[model samples]
Target chain A: MRRWLARVGALTAAAVLIAATAPIIMADDLTVTRGAGDGGVAREREIRDIKSEIHRLEQRVDQLENENGQLKKSNAELKQNADKLQTSTTQQLSEIQSRASAPPSPADFMDAMNRFLGRYRFTLVGGAAGSYIYDRKSNTNTFALDLEPIILWQLSDKLLFEGTIEANLPAGSSADYQLPVADFQYFLNDYAELVMGIFDQPFGDWYEDQSPFWVNRFITAPLPYNVGSLIPPTEVGLQLRGGFQWGEMGQVADYTIWSGNGPGYTNATCGSNTPPSPLPDCSTTTALVGDTLVSDNNIRLNTHSPGFGGRFRVYPLPADSNFGRLELGASTFDGKWLDGFWLTSWGVDFNYFRDNLQARGEWIQTYRQMPQGLGADNRQGWYVQAGYFLTGLQVPLLPSELDQYIDRLEPLIRYSGINQRATVLGNVITTPGIGFTGSPALYAPHAREVAVGLDYWFAPSIVWQNELDLELPRAGGFYSDTGQAVGAYPNDRAFVSQFAVGF
Target chain B: MSRLIKFGMMAALAAIALVPLAPRHARAAEMTPAQQKRQMFRRGAQLWPIYCNTCHNARPGGEFSPTEWNMIIMHMRTQANLPPQDANAILEYLKASR
Candidate 1:
């Protein structure tokens, strides 16, 4: 060990800083056009404080660099002293060596802290993806790509600050764009937390886990996850949540709750029923209306009500050998964007993994409420999917002949459904429907699709995903433009093939 | 203060390395669902090393909510291009820690 220590070299200042503060202390990569409240003064002061802290941290890093070299030597010395102080372990041995006894020493104490220790880390993510699509109905084949990267700084054991930017070229259709999601988090006693900055809108499970491309079997989360993408999943605001576990039906259970921005997407739907654009900009009326904000989308587009919701996911299949992994969950919200809208939802996800096969199924129900005459559209929707893996896999090169030629391969098939009311798409009149009070031009995009997919994972990081899109027959009408003559489903069939790595 | 600084540096490194290893520890133990939910603090603290340990401090029950933590994971997923499942795992880990 001493020989290994002697061969080491001095580490860089950047490396030391990266080590001392958990690398995340300085990796924010987002900048925006918005200014802080009370003008730029607050921002200026904050900048000043950060600069001072950076200096202090750097100095501390330099000192730690010196101490790291001593840790090994110190440990060795302590171990030696402990050895010198001890002669034998058992009573029989101690009796034979009476003079070998030594007083309790702090030698062991120093080493104990070394074991109960933590670590620091910093990560940088930058990626690019090009989408090439050929749609027979639209008679179009298009290719586009997007690039963005993120950096995060873990300041302490319980503090985190992160920054992100989205850069796409040529806007929405062109695949050219840029957006930033930056925030600071303070874990207030573990279960309780406080966060302020741009964040994802939390309507369901899909939106929160929309990336890596490895977790899912498709292009993205369901459209309803963010109200048809009309609303930015990330909003600026503060959120609070905390929950714990208990016993239920002979299994483990979990629950969580949150509050932030709730009424942003309502304005888009409320516009059709209101005079023009009527945002739910009544932050003060949350108690009156009983709405809370879980994610802030901004005042310009928000209905101004806070968003609040709770969730519970439990495992209750009685621990079957190879047939059961089931979880049931429910989340509900009451928010006012244009007029005031409500959503109550519940879902179930089931998984059964046995031997060389896996199966999964899920269903969700969302009940919505609007004003009697203005925002008068009420609706619910859901879907289900199941799949299985055929191949029994093992490493090919580790002295096993059966693994080399095959690598890895599996085929899958699936079908799903959805139903929605036309009012959700920004249709419907004020007196006849629950309308949009913030923006009149707003409308909703509603439809359903059933897709069959084939995916193959050759290596752990290498995969081939291919899917055929089949439209489901389902729709509702609110007005003439949105009421175009059509069948139960209008989405044409399309195929998607994707190759990705690093999750 | 100096000792605290030393602790900060070494602790930061150990925490950083914990990010990847976090998934391994991401499992929130077999506490009752109620304890798991209330273990927000304990779980949050536990999560400090696995999920946030890479770039943030190991403040465990220190900052953020299970939901807020979920949102952050979402942002990082889209912004940093993290895969959906990994994002979910991180979310689950962060949530449990909270």
Candidate 2:
């Protein structure tokens, strides 16, 4: 602006000098003409012409001054505009920094609360399941619904509380509600924690870690971990649990030790041993009372002794390694039956996980002393499963959008077998006045199953699952909706479908 | 001198107990960038057992790049109802470790 003003001032000065000198130069020309003996008429005309020229120069100077004033005004306006723009830019930058440094807004806090706060989380899983089964007598299709609502509260960095509520609708039965787990864990350090309340039986990967509807690949659990498989699923207990980190690996070991209400049995035995082969001669030995059945240990029948259990896990690879994480686990439980007999269960499991692949296998055995002279019931089962993500293989024909959707799809296959030897006692009746003593052999019959399934995850916690199960060798009965034997079936092949969601 | 040492030890224990009780994400407000990064790593470590281990064994951090982690977390956030800020923390942790 200053440079422009300097130029304008120089031009204005030059115009003024020209305007002041033009008339004198014209007058001198007229005088020279007169000295050369010019006419008076011509001199007058020259004078008039000089006056007109001077007037024109003056007018030109005035126009230049007007232009200079306009230029000054425009420069001032431009300067004002520049100042406003700089102020606006500074304010915008300050606003951005303030936003960056500010704490979470009210809306964000509210959203966190709605999503179960930063310290708390809630997940609702399970779904409606339908099944079609082919039995020896007939073919039947059935539907059932199940719900598991899970809530977790992180009280502090070291303290956490979790609860799971389950409601199940069994085929041909009313709905059953259960508090499967409600526990609080207090971290002692990075290595251990104290857990109290009703918790999942920490016997294997299926019981404590991978049993949720959204997590597991298959719709139904294997025989060993399913209902009435003789393996306890949950218990009211106190536990000490922890994991260890070794070297640069993520986690080397995980362990849990717990004590809870011991297991019990019902109608085990009631008669004295006799010398006769049929054992109906009631004169030789003391009478044996039958064991009471207590699948759940909510009410302790034996106050003096509590069930003791433990699980130990070893991870061979780093927990976060991209190749895969492999884990081996062993678990055991020891308790006294309600009939005062001893019971014990033990299991071993292996799990391998990678971004595109997962494989798990488990073997569990349960033993209980017979109330009568019959030998103890030894029941055991083992299952191996594998799931592969189709997208991980990078099939060429798949489009990008299809690939994303397919990435969430996992196809799985499992093979499992259960063997049981506890049917004899159920055939012999010991109580008086009750005439019926039917064999329950079908309840825990021996069988092998090959299952194929697909899990399509809508989200991390939501899945649509469909599976077909083939149980061979014409078992005593088929497993019902609750995974327990109910009606009669020679051989069973079932198609099961479920829609599951979490959170 | 012995008494002073005992008092100092007691105070130190108290601090340890109190420190973890603060909101982990909120505590990052006054921290430097490096400190915040470290805190995110710690938070991700803690969250692995709580959330990831519930369904499946947690994947190792070396399994994916920062970009992959970001995509994976975004997918999980929707499924798990994880807050954006918490998701970012986990993402930062994975990226930093990677």
Top candidate, metric lDDT = 2
Model 2, range A48-104, lDDT digits (tens) per residue?
776776677668667767887998899999999999999999999999999889998
User: How high a TM-score does candidate 2 get?
Assistant: 0.61
In model 2, how large is the Cα lDDT of residue A32?
A: 65
Q: List the DockQ of the predictions in order.
A: 0.03, 0.08
Error of 1 at A451 (Å): 1.0
- What DockQ number belongs to candidate 2? 0.08
TM-score of each: 0.51, 0.61
Once model 2 is optimally superposed onto the true structure by TM-score, how far is the C-alpha of residue A402 displaced, in angstroms? 5.3
Model 2 bad stretches (over 4 Å): A1-138, A266-304, A319-323, A392-406, A423-444, A474-488, B1-54, B57-98
lDDT of 1 by residue, A1-503 (tens): 55334433333454455467543433321121153345455545665676676676668656665676698689999998877667434655767576446543333433344345444234454444444444444444444344556556566645677666655442124433334467776555422445566665443444443343443555433323322332235545665433222332213333334455554433332222332222232222122111122222453454446655444444554332234444455444444554545544445544443333444444555544544332433333344544455454565455666554343554555454434443332222111000001011111234455656666665443456665666544432332122333333255665556554422
